[model samples]
Target: MTIREAFTDLINQRGWYVKLEIPEGTANSTKKRFLEGKPVTEDKMKEILQRAGYRIKQVELWEK
Candidate 1:
């Protein structure tokens, strides 16, 4: 399945709130790197967002 599809599936399966974050300060600069905008694939981004407790309660795409 596509990353977007996978994300949607996850949300549908689990109430739109995924948490995929490594414990703060556990990994030096890892969180920082993520926060600082490291490159990520759709699958990877989906995983991270899910781990970080971010759910797709709504889909909003802004074209600019």
Candidate 2:
């Protein structure tokens, strides 16, 4: 399965949050490359996930 599918399964079936942790000193640069100044929307996320062979077709909102 793709990384996106696996991650979705983690939260949906396992009821967990997928948090990525970076090395202590690399956090700042990593944020600038990924998190900083980047829009956190479905499209943007899908683009990032696509690099790992993830093609998001649909999204379901949960009350959890």
Q: How high is the CA lDDT of each candidate model?
A: 0.50, 0.43
Per-residue lDDT tens digits for candidate 2, residues 38-64, read 534555445435543546565655795
**RMSD per model, one decimal:** 9.6, 10.1
Task: Please report how far candidate 1 places residue 14 from its true position, in Å.
Answer: 27
> For candidate 2, what is the TM-score?
0.28
Judge candidate 2 at residue 26 and give its lDDT: 48
Clashing pairs in 2: none
- Top TM-score prediction, candidate number: 1
Worst 10 residues of 1 by lDDT: 14-23
TM-score per candidate, in order?
A: 0.32, 0.28
Clashes of each: 7, 0
